[model samples]
Target: MPIKASTGAAYARVEGIGAAIPSRVVDNHEMTQFIETSDEWIQQRTGIVERRWAAEDETVESLSLEAARNALAHAGVEASDIDAVIVSTVSHLIQTPSLAAIVAAKLGTDGAAAFDIAAACAGFSYGLAQADSLVRSGAARRVLVIGAETLSRITDTSDRATAFLFADGAGAAVVGPSDVPSMGPVVWGSDGDQAHVINMNRTWPEAVESGLPSQLTMQGQAVFRWATGFIADAARRTLDAAGLAPEELDLFVPHQANNRITDSMLRHLKLPDTVTVGRTIRHFGNNSAASIPIALDAMIASGEAKSGDTCLIIGFGAGLVYAGQVITIP
Candidate 1:
């Protein structure tokens, strides 16, 4: 007997988007109390005035559920309609029983297949790529992609370098079959040699032995150089791969890492002035994986971005990894 192949959707598109911001806000002045930095310096350096930190009542799971529910509602989809769930984050803090599984149950996903990915700041895009593939390959019909982070818990507050850069939040999107091609090819890769540029200060076992919590560490200058140079070129390649000219792009939403880096990329890409860029980092801080999707939801809500707009989104961090793609705004 001959085997049969499963058929799937010809294309996939993001049906809707949503975000969950933490309740507590941490301004630059509060950052100053923990580090030797000033308000003007923080804003001038990173374009961040303040960022949100989770309240005592908020947890990664709760944020994920909120974002997921909102996305499902926006998509006009029931929880049971989701065939799979993909969560991208480094803040789950557990080694097993993945956050995706827990979130799926909480969202009443009807036993949808669920798992998690750890690609640091590039995680959301990475998860999107997987969801697109899964839907198109018939492995799943509809996929929920969530990017959430609670970097505040792992941040070394005494370290002046990163004390103000990390925050907490969650953002999600529902991807389903599309009648037309709305998603572009994903351009992604990693450079393990530069993994040390952004990483934790210690391993779990090491932290346990030393009686200290593992905290995030970074080489800021190196990241800036790589992002502006290599990542900028990658963004250009992403736009080109999508068959879009710089002028044809309506929005540019890169990882909310640093405003200076965003400016440098703008110079490199030479995008026209009409293109709306994502500057949510000024208020949200660098929430790692959640940055891109959070920016997307905000831009759409604020009218800076609209449905059917062509947007270029890219993410890079930690693993010195990167991923970019052109997506039609949902």
Candidate 2:
């Protein structure tokens, strides 16, 4: 027998979602001066057109706080109503106090059990599970989870392969109790086996405060192979865990890692083109943790989803990690 909500007896639901990107935009063609790659090569290889770059003053804390405010406002939930804050990122510039704690203080959401969780690009989905769990266990009434990154900070301008694909941004969502299971059980997995295939350590500064010197390095082809197969497997397992099938889903929100990766995963799942929220990171570049939630905000604002619509959110990133959740809108 599962425990029920205090004032309510029901499952958890996503009340609202919001995303914030920096004002500065970087396009691939502009990479000619910074790297050896051509605009045509970038376009054909990665479906990215442009991405936002953070200004010197724009820190991850600021970006996450802005996203949190928007998510709280959109959800119509008071700051005091939030019981926890989880920030997912690998680019959290600081080493202590936790980025979530700082954002909570800025938002005036005091006393909340704030913390951070890093799963690389799959961070948001991983955090979503944490937030959703908080609601389900009756441990909290509302939880604020944010996925933020500043990949530009560590990107080696000389390394064309990495400098062009990684950028900065943040996105957030609020979860609370619902009248029914508004979201499906998340299915997640890890392949500690494939971790080293995509790593960055060959930069001028050698390395940074933590692992990999903050710069993203990867063998594009190797990642492409791992991504397509891994994501498809996660998707199938997620839908099955939710007790649903591919055709039953109304919308599929996948991590905006790469257009090719997204397409390949979708094809393997046998899902049609109309089911995806694709090409976000392609244009915005891989904002790492922020990718999926940013697309979620866009999908909702565009009215692409409606009441009772089933939306599947999936994320894949470092740790060779991947996860997905099935959600229903109110």
* lDDT values for all models: 0.95, 0.81
Q: Taking the tens digit of each residue's C-alpha lDDT, what string does model 1 give over 252-322?
A: 99999999999999999999999999999999999999999999999989999999999999999999899
User: How do all models score by TM-score?
Assistant: 0.99, 0.92
Cα shift from native, residue 61, model 2 (Å): 0.8
**Candidate 1 wrongly placed segments (more than 4 Å):** none
As a TM-score, model 1 comes out at 0.99
For residues 229-298, write the lDDT of model 2, one tens digit per residue.
8677788788888888778888887888788887777777777555645457766788988998887777
Question: Which run of 10 residues does model 1 get worst, by summed lDDT?
Answer: 1-10
